[model samples]
Target: MNDPIRGTARGSAPAPLSVLDTALAGRGVSAADALSGSIALAELAERRGFTRYWVTEHHSMPGVSSSSPAVLLARLTAHTTRLRLGAGGVMLPNHPPLIVAEQYGLLQALAPDRIDLGLGRAPGTNQATAAALRRGRSDDDFPQQVVELLRFLDDDFPEEHPYRERVYAVPGPGQDKENGLPQTTGRPSVWLLGSSGYSAQLAARLGLPFAFAAHFSPDHVAGALRLYRDRFTPSAVLTEPYALASFAVMAADDEHEALRQTRSYAHSMMRMLHGKSYLVPTADEAASYPYTASEQLVLDRWTNTVLHGTPDRVTVHLDRLHEAARPDEIMIASVGHTPQALLRSTELIADAYTLPSTPVPVSAR
Candidate 1:
């Protein structure tokens, strides 16, 4: 298929498309359904040629059910073969480095080359919850924690290191070879997820891939990416920098419907900003809710940051963003309240980009 807006072949489209998902639970969706929807969407993403599927972590958030990204991603492996599945990030501060390494290590063992372990510095919840999850641990130690986690993943502790030979992530590096297990299931690729320069710089120093969270923090996208490329240092994981930009995008066959969906997301975001219950409102609810002048301004600002419209319009905007930032990949974080809307938006965007859908072989399935 060809790009609808540019009338060019799919290969010419800006960059490879991937997915960033938060198993949203709100309005007509139950928590179980949200998880199930993620599975279905990942399967579709693989068939539609999306590069990878990354689920983010959120804790005790009313409208978010993706509290455990590793668990959700585990389920996805059974449903898809080609799709690269990962935690958009596991909030490192909330759990011990060894635990996080073990979880992802086991995942790598299960999914082989298809797993990714994206790390983030921030706690994905409020202060109270962060305290509860972290106990007395300090978030300021994030960089150190990342190094420790990587060591566990690689099973490469120096002789002088305290944990060398004393600790290990069982399913991690050398496990398969030592135990005579299949070597096909290698370790997960690492990526740093961020909305600022700190994360970009850390990723650069370590020579890991960097994925900017433009979906939430649009203002820093260009600057953060620039810092990453400028300060990059070659390492074993990467010889050069690889950057991925994620954006909140929704595409529909009809422009009006797309607008309504975006408005619904705006209302939900407004509620979140105000520290309200954070349930996603339906499009009809959003359309009928009376907004104060200030609230309307907030809504407008949020909507402007997102790319929403017909498939052609959205793809055009995506191409422009790619040209400006020059990310190696473009990841779409669909912001629709309902599962069906999310699926439809994904399908429309794939069609617009003419992404080839390779059917899964029966044996693989």
Candidate 2:
């Protein structure tokens, strides 16, 4: 089949996917301001021919402030004309299914064809924080919640079923009789997000698309895809596995700049490990972090999968990733010590991957 990604000859190619994330310019800017900035950036990505602009959800975060993805997505959706807008993921364990349905349905109502919801099981924070957000819900029951959410979105429960009689998503877009679920006047599309085997298999069994969080999960990238593809049994939505791999793409004018910029992520990762994940700092501020020797080594290891270097250099690695994973789409997450640095990374990545004269016509979004 022809790979929609590049319109090129295909022996084992996946279709081109939409690109970019909503947390475009990292840094401690307020969510409102960041959204405003990202709106312009998304416009740039669209004009540059990138695919999607996915915002992520994180709560009680100081450095990063992407708390309400649905609300932010709606705002960003209003600003951009085309680049598909979505959530890199909303943590399922944190919110009720109906709430998710209602919020996204509202967004879908506003931006019909351009809404997407990628769900992850992680709290995106510490246990205490997750506990606070979840009230009394069981994180152990995430799988069940995922299923329930899917059924709600599909609104596929037959009326004859007793459960269907007493239970229904009041705010569900309604079922598209054809889909046996609530009818969608065209709200957000759903995607399962993962970092390992469990999510991959779940996505397969559910017959929904999957997005792997390769940004901080380089080691499991190939393995997760392997499970996803191996266990996949075609379903109604997809005949084969449709995998999207997210990565930290930090491209700059030079290797040194890229490496230095990556310190932001390293620091953030450290904070996460210790319960203080914050938005990336300014380059000047980042230089001031007193990382211990051991901490530096850990981050270096964690940064293994991150693509850092000039566009040409980064493209070489990206091509290798494509060869190995053959993802339908590649979502680039360029978080740097400063907003300007992050914007530069995104620009350079766009340049490296979007060249009309590049010899390799690979376009995995």
In TM-score terms, candidate 2 sits at: 0.85
TM-score of each model, in listed order: 0.94, 0.85
Q: How many residue pairs clash in each candidate?
A: 0, 17
Local error of candidate 2 at 163, Å? Answer: 6.2
How many angstroms is residue 270 displaced in model 2 relative to the true structure, after the best TM-score fit?
Answer: 1.5
Candidate 1 segments exceeding 4 Å error: 1-12, 174-184, 363-365
The TM-score obtained by model 1 is 0.94
lDDT of 2 at 252: 92
Per-residue alpha-carbon lDDT of candidate 1 for residues 61-155, written as tens digits (9 for 90 to 100): 87779999989988887887767888898999889998988898888767777788888978887777878998999779888999999998888
Writing each residue's lDDT as its tens digit, candidate 2 over 46-131 gives 65556677777776666565677777777766566555777878898899987787777677667766677888888977788888
Model 2 segments more than 4 A misplaced: 1-17, 20-28, 160-184, 277-279, 355-365
Rate residue 343 of model 1 by lDDT: 83
